[model samples]
Target: MINPLGIVITVLYYKIAEKIKKISIFSKIPPIVIAGVMLIATLEIFDIDYDIYNESAKYLTIILIPATIALGYPIYKNIELLKKNKRIIYTGFIIAAVIAILTTYVVAKMCNTEFIVIESMLPKSVTAPMAVEISKGIGAIPELTACIVALTGIFGGVFGHKILKLIKVKSDVAIGLSIGAASHVIGTARCIEEKRESQVVMASVALVIVGIITAIIIPLFIYLIK
Candidate 1:
């Protein structure tokens, strides 16, 4: 049986998130987080089965691919800027990737975390889909990788700008790279909301580059380390 209530709940939560975002103080809270909390509360109150809800709402997840592809428009519009800053962009991407991997490894080691746990965390900065694939290739838990990736996105989307500002990162490219490299899609959404086309382009570009690099390099790195 089709669950229309699941779809209705998703739509209503999104609208509520939009409304919450319009308020002054709550404006900084990421809409996804608001929608997530609302969804959980609603599910509990209504005693909805998550499995059934997810099955009915699976179409929403499918739309993410096209939405990601549509980011090409912004990248095309700022092609000149991307070309002009190719050196800086690639440098930032490599450095960010290295730092992400190293930090995860070191922290996991310090905690005496399992090797598989460390491996899963290696791709934590990338988007969930890529991270999950990378986790699988490296023999890590995909579900754990997805959870870490989501938490990273939520944290970065909420505090990324403030962190960049605190560090005096005034350049749009640098800000975009930092946020996108650390947070993925959620961070890109935050950039889009800022209405800065250049930031949006660079963030999207960084995300794509990081995803590719993580997918390729992380597997090789894991092999070498093993």
Candidate 2:
């Protein structure tokens, strides 16, 4: 039942991907993305069932609970930042959630995208765990929601800073919120890569607030539109 080899392979894939991530051209690509791709390739080559892999590696998912709680550290360190700009920060999260959902919905409708896809993508900007639950609650495909969320995060993490700089927006809070609201934890991880504690702290908070805000509105919006 406990397949140690699956655990070893999973960790090894991620470790190798992390090393690959150090390359300048590959720097923007997150290790998880690379590791996930490689793992999929390996599984297909070996004809391994995903169930076997997931059963062994499910323990890793538990670590996310503590990792999420640890984000409170940055918030504690930067509590003053929130205290000083609670209005702006809260407003930003709300605006970001509303815009992300509205735009996705409108565009998908215009494009005649599938109902299932639109529902799944409605929460694409949210973090995986919350996004998955939202997808289910809204009667969407959780698997598709997870994939779209990952891609959205990757896109935001890779280009968020570059796009901000291109526009001459240098404020860490703005940058963090933009990336975090758009991409969730992966974009926040990009903030970590930049070593800007200001960015990281704000980003971590952005995803949480934005996630909550999105979760509340999306189901209501779906019900209204459908």
Maximum-lDDT candidate? 2
Q: Return the number of clashes found in candidate 2.
A: 0
Candidate 2, residues 110-140: lDDT per residue as tens digits? 9999999999999989888788778888889
Model 1, 13-87: lDDT tens digits are 989999998999987666666887898887899898888888888777667567645656755766787688688
> For candidate 2, which ten residues in a row score worst on lDDT?
62-71
TM-score of each: 0.77, 0.84
Clash pairs, candidate 2, are none
Q: Let me know the TM-score candidate 1 reaches against the reference structure.
A: 0.77
Per-residue lDDT for 146 in model 1? Answer: 75
Error of 1 at 206 (Å): 1.6
